[model samples]
Target: MNNINSGWRSGILEKIQGRLMKVYLLARRFRKHIKDLKNIPRTPRCGLSKQETIINKH
Candidate 1:
C-alpha cells in the first residue's frame, strides 16, 4: 500500500514540475520578445499629418 501511494505522489509531482517548466520557458520567450521590440527605433508620426490634411479638405 505504501509503495502504491509513493508512486502516485511521484506521478503528481512530475506533472507539476512539467507545468512549471513550460510556464518558465513561455515567460522567458515573452521577455525576449519584449526586449527585441524595445531595441527597434521609433518612426515619425506621418499618419497623423495625412489624416489632418484629409480632414481639412472635407
Candidate 2:
C-alpha cells in the first residue's frame, strides 16, 4: 500500500514538471517570434522617412 501511494505521488510530480517545461518552451518561442518580427522591413509613406530631405519654402 505504501509503495502504491509513493508511485502515485511520483507520477503527479512528473506531470507537474512536464507542464512547467511546456510553459517555459512556449514563452521562449513567443519571445523569439517578437524578436524576428522586429527585423521585418517597413514601407515609408508620403514620400518621406527620417533620413529623407524635407524642403519648405515661404
Candidate 3:
C-alpha cells in the first residue's frame, strides 16, 4: 500500500537525518578543537640551528 511505503520512507529518512545531525555535531567539535590548536602560540626553535650544524659535521 502507498501508506506503508510512505511510512517506510519516513523511517529511513529519519535515520539518515539522525546520522547527519551526529556528523554535524562531530564536525563542529573537530573544528573547535582545530581552532583551539591554532590559537596556541608556537615555541621558538632556539638552538636548533646549532644542533643541526653539529649533526651535519658527522
- In model 2, the clashing pairs are none
- Higher-lDDT candidate of 1 and 3: 1
Q: Is candidate 2 or candidate 3 better by lDDT?
A: 3
Predicted candidate 1 versus true structure: per-residue lDDT over 1-58, tens digit per residue: 9999999999999999999999999899777755645544463467555544654573
Residue-wise lDDT of candidate 3 within 1-58, one digit each (tens)? 9999999999999999999999999899777755645544453455455444654573
Identify the runs in model 1 with alpha carbons over 4 angstroms from their true place. Answer: 43-58
In order, how many clashes per candidate?
0, 0, 0
Query: Once superposed on the true structure, which residue ranges of model 3 sit more than 4 Å away at CA?
Result: 42-58
Identify the runs in model 2 with alpha carbons over 4 angstroms from their true place. Answer: 38-58
Q: After superposition, how far is residue 8 of candidate 1 from its true place, in Å?
A: 0.3
Backbone clash total for model 3 is 0
Best by lDDT: 1
| CA-lDDT, candidates in order | 0.73, 0.65, 0.71
TM-score of every prediction relative to native: 0.66, 0.58, 0.68
Maximum-TM-score candidate: 3
Candidates ranked by TM-score: 3, 1, 2
lDDT of 2 by residue, 7-56 (tens): 99999999999999999998897677556445434534533332233222
